[model samples]
Target: MHIKTRLTILNFLEFFSWGAWLLSAGAYMSTTLGFTGVQIGSVYATLGIASIFMPPVIGIIADRWIPAEKLFGISHLLLAGLFVVLTSMTSFNSFYMVTFLVALVYMPTLALSNSISYYNLEKEGLDSVVTFPPIRVWGTVGFIIAAWLVDVLGLKVSHEQFYLAAAASVLLGGYSFSLPLIPIVKNTSRTLFQRFGLDAFVLFKNKNLAIFLVFSVLLGAALQITNIWGVPFLNDFSISYKDSFVVKHAVFLMSLSQVSEVLFILAIPFFLKRFGIKIVVLISMFAWVFRFGFFGVGSPEGMGLLFLITSMIIYGMAFDFYVISGSLYVDKMSDAKVRSSAQGLFMMMVNGFGAVLGAYISGFVVDYYTANNGIKDWASIWFICAVYALIIGVLFALVFRYKHTGEENLVIKK
Candidate 1:
């Protein structure tokens, strides 16, 4: 098979494992397992907790000892076993422990998968910028398809979603061994701190970079709110709109956000070139405002449903703009020597610290709005989220300062 085809399948199954359960897991925990908001939030926070340090640690192992492909395969095989273990746990402490372990093994694979792709693409003499986006987009397609399958097969509310994810992880893990081997680069000059990418922390002295990373954490918090609550929020409408398609196929409807994501990614180059990074990121912030506000006002019928659909569509801008543009800005601002580490730091801020903040705080907000009888006030919850996003946008516009040069370019370097 062609390398491109092989990489496409690799990317597909990579995200397929995540898509099988991420959005619906909250609903399952809430309605089936009888977990409280705090418990569920803590469970989802495991991703952020593991993402904070594991990727860099894993990167060190791949850098010094093992080939990237070998490590990638091992991570997934481990993840498959963990997912299987997840199916058998029902207690809060046991479930949280297993989920955190799964996150530890699984999160690093995200970086590993990208590393594997870049290695193979370069080996085949393909321009990664040109060939990889099309291949990578299939990951989004895989996510959408997985979500739809869960919904259609009636697995969204059952442990069976974990089974589906485990099956995909097993296949991906086995297939990874067949990919081109990534040779480990032995660099003897680097210090222990440098190996862990801790050297990038020196960039904190730069006022602009410091401010931008601070906001990255704040915006990162917004990233997972919908993922954790979106399905359950829609499922709540089952009481009012029993026959509505939105209620019955909530996961399918939520998959539209990923579809929007694929489309918006194509537009990022143009937006970055024309508006510059600051304005582009600000646009993303406001998009989040709309993303939540629309959900606050939307229902499963009439104009409310339109608001819901609009929220899903706006998710593309809210997500892709900040993440892509912020990464580009970090690349431009940092020195070339620490550039890769700088990017790692950026991910740590947004996906790690930011995600943890969002999970706990959002959980508190959700529980605060719930009555003693278990009735949740979703509108209040969503409006609070919208307000938080708006505050971040306005504060970012006023406090963060950057002069945009028209010469900025978006380059994806491995």
Candidate 2:
């Protein structure tokens, strides 16, 4: 197989492992395990908790001593076992412990995947900036496929989704061994912190980077809210009206967001170049307003479903433009030695600290607004999120400034 093809397969399995459960896990928690919103939110925060330091720590190891491929394999193997253990635990506290352990293993793989991809691409003499987005899009496709499969197979509310994910994890773990070996060349001259992408913090000395990091954290906090709440939000619509069509297939409907993700992912190069990060990200933020507003105001009936559908459509832009474009921006600014760590730090901010904050706060909001029957006051929740995004968007526009030279225009054409 071509190296690109092999990497594409790797990318697919990489995301498939997460997609099998991440989105639908809420349904399983709420409907099957009878977990409250706060409880489920706490469970989801495990990803954030693990991410706070693990990525950078593992990244330091990968940058210096361990080969990226080997570490990637071991993480997956550990996570597969954890997922199996998670499936066996029936109680909330036990499940939380198991899931947190799984996240400790699983979260680091995200950074490792990027590191391995960059390392292998360099070896193959490929342009990572040009090549990676297309490769990464397949990961979203895999995620979409997993959502569809879970919805269609009626696995969203069952333990089988974790089993399916675990199977994929095992496959991915074993397959990672077959990829080209990445060298372990440590930077002997550097201090301990420098090896961990901590050196990239120097960028914070620049006003633009400092502002970028702050907004990125704010936006990242906003980012996970939909994924954490979207499925359950839609599922609640069904509970209010048991015979409702939307109730029977809430997961499939929610899967539309992932479907839209593939299209937006392909559009990133075009959008990022023409509009630049400011406008492109602004569009994404505004899209989030619509995303939340629609959910808040619309229902499963009448024109409400239209609002729901539109919200899902805009999610493609909301997710892709912010994350993919922000990553590329970091790439443009950082040095090669610390690039992987910088990326991990970015994730730590958005996925780690941001996610933890979002999960905890969202749980409080849901618990405050929801009825005993588990029917949520979704409008209030989404409205609050929309306001939060709007504030961030305005702050980013007013505070974060950069000139979009034609450099990235040339980049996208590749």
- For each candidate in the order shown, give its overall lDDT on alpha carbons: 0.83, 0.81
- Pairs with steric clashes in candidate 1: none
Please give the distance, in angstroms, between residue 70's alpha carbon in candidate 2 and its true position after superposition: 1.4
**Judged by lDDT against the true structure, how good is candidate 1?**
0.83
Which ranges of candidate 1 are over 4 A from the true structure? 1-4, 118-132, 195-197, 202-207, 327-343, 409-414
For model 2, the superposed segments whose C-alpha errors exceed 4 Å read 195-197, 408-414
TM-score against truth, every candidate: 0.91, 0.94
Root-mean-square deviation of Cα positions for candidate 1 versus the true structure, in angstroms: 2.8
Candidate 2's TM-score: 0.94
Question: Top model by TM-score, which number?
Answer: 2
| Steric clashes per prediction | 0, 0
